[model samples]
Target: MKKSPRRTFIRDTAIAATGFFIVPRHTLGRGFVAPSDKLNIAGIGVGGKAEVNLPFAWNNGSDNIAALCDVDDRMAVKARARWPKAPYYKDYRVLLEKEQKNIDAVIITTPDHMHAVQALAAMQLGKHVYLEKPLTHDIYEARTLTKAAEKYRVVTQMGNQGSSGDDTRLVETWIQSGVIGEVKKVHVWTNRPTWPQGVPVPKGSFNVPAELDWDLWLGTAPQRDYNPAFLPAIWRGWSDYGTGSLGDMGCHFIDVPYRALKLGYPVSVECNVGSVYTGFFQEAIYYESYPPSSITYIQFPARGEMPPVEMIWYDGGMKPPRPAELQPEEQMGELDGGIIFEGSTGKLMAGLFGRKPTLLPLSKMASATLPKSAFEFVENGSDGHQQQWVKACKKGYGAYTSSSFDKSG
Candidate 1:
């Protein structure tokens, strides 16, 4: 007789569930779930996005949050109040080392620069990971993480929730239907830099706050003074800690045209940025921070029967030319940003998160009947984004996921 691998895995995993609460089968109602069935999850950067991300994992009813790690205690206060029982740590390395036995997976919502190291370490330990967007700060890191997912054979997903949305699929269908003809160009714009950017590095330093671990927050970044300018989300605008506006929103908007047109790695990229002047006489380059505004153009080769495509990105209140099809009263994109695909025949557009995709020339949209939905909507829609990864973890690796690190990273 051969041993059942499922039973073997459960028997072995029982050793790791030392302190987990196991709901008894009889009291579990019709669907009696065993303790071993749920994934014991840990969270890194358990604030900001984790405010919603962590709760989404728990909402799936098949995940148990075992621990949380954050560099600043003040920022983590809200998360701690919600998941009071989960053990807390100030550093991710220590959390991974000490709690390795207790966790089955990890959710990394940390800053851009710190993402690669923390995620790579978790993968090395055989834990699944759900990383936030712009998977890495560098192209090298992105390639490394993508390859590591296959090497480690772990379930991996990026935090580009739009990948799980039906709107993304709808855009694909419209393009394939030839309604928009061949998409030769795309314009993606955002109004980010709502935070500070294009400024000189702050010379003044402040004493580290009692609740913050300045050293830990610096992570892989070079050592620097404890400046508030780099903390509490302002880091996104800095060169050392963040990837600028392009890095901030690229993954989200690019995912649309990239997936819709079946685009691949860009062949060439060109960009221009606005100058940051600090004084009446001196124009500050502020290499330390991202520009106040910038525009980048990326060219992708043709795929299969599709023609070569040119994609443009705008940030810091800059935008592409409005389409002639757009009415005088109609808005181009929302205040935050939007994605516009230009085909020989017409254009299709969507707002942030790829919601509410519509064809230009409102009349065309009203008269044309949509083709049968060629793509199946993710169950539970966008909220299912987190749960999809959670289910894949429980279902074992190789389970299909929309934004697997191999694709997004």
Candidate 2:
């Protein structure tokens, strides 16, 4: 593949960021050059979550944000302002083509459906990719992207930030130390309370914003009338653009237990969905949308060194029944999200989103001693997810959260 001019810029940025000694240009072997030098990065879908991660990418040592792309010009404006020197575009393809040589890696924070297409295109051109999670909208896309990453030999990282969290490491340690004993089942929940669940689609015709490119936003999804409800953040509840609440947070909430147990693809997945009918329909009343909630049951068969386990995911105002041993007062302070492990020896409860979990049945938890062999915490402080990607790209190091084609598929 003919490398683009952007490759030079990317190499320089990587070098500067890492303060690595640049190899003399005269010594460059036939085609090989040090991976680190400088890195030229591009941001896709510069709205919503993209806004949060874009700044981090820069902070992590991206020399220059070469391009900014988003369907909604309004959304891109903020990012453009932040990186005044970078060129901007409404379509990602145009950005990619124009900045082909000026860009080395692309950060995809687009809607779920567009992730695979845009990412695959970038990888085809040999650009490293840092994609937001669930990895892809559907299982197949996940599989395809994984294959592309391997084929291209491009550095890749999923947006599961928690995978790099200290709390997550703590959870892993606790499990490995036998603090939770043999886990047979786990329940995870998040307060995905958005619009009235179970409510019917709203009936209305509203003018689409001029700055918003509706068709591009729809992308591969079936076309539908413009609805403000789906825009911004509430789209997660809808089946089309977003992946219900489960897809939204599964990667984050379930990631800890998944890693601790070395979970693989689930054997079967069955959803106990709320009363939301199929077909293209918008919710009319907030309360009339989907039935205020649903629970998805995922069953995973035994993997190496791990036994089969049942995982229950709860969201949209639904919660698992409280353990009988806990007093009513003890449950009062519990937040809307968390995980509970039902082990053969005892039960353990953790705070929402993988906080260092505490043993349940307060009394027994206090008396129990954990095993000695466990990962010790070292203070490398700060959320280093973005930094990890930057270092990996510069050094050609493989990522810890790299999803496999088979597992994600």
For TM-score, the strongest prediction is 1
Segments in model 1 whose C-alpha atoms lie over 4 Å from true places? 1-36, 279-281
How big is the positional error of residue 30 in model 2, measured in Å on the Cα after superposition? 13
lDDT of 1 by residue, 179-250 (tens): 889889999998887889888788885888999987677766776888888878889999899998889888
Per-residue error for 50 in candidate 1, Å, reads 0.3
lDDT of each: 0.82, 0.70
Q: After superposition, how far is residue 236 of candidate 2 from its true place, in Å?
A: 1.6
**Lowest-scoring 10 consecutive residues by lDDT in candidate 1?**
17-26
Model 2 alpha-carbon drift over 4 Å, by segment: 1-36, 60-62, 196-201, 276-291, 332-334, 363-368, 371-382, 397-409
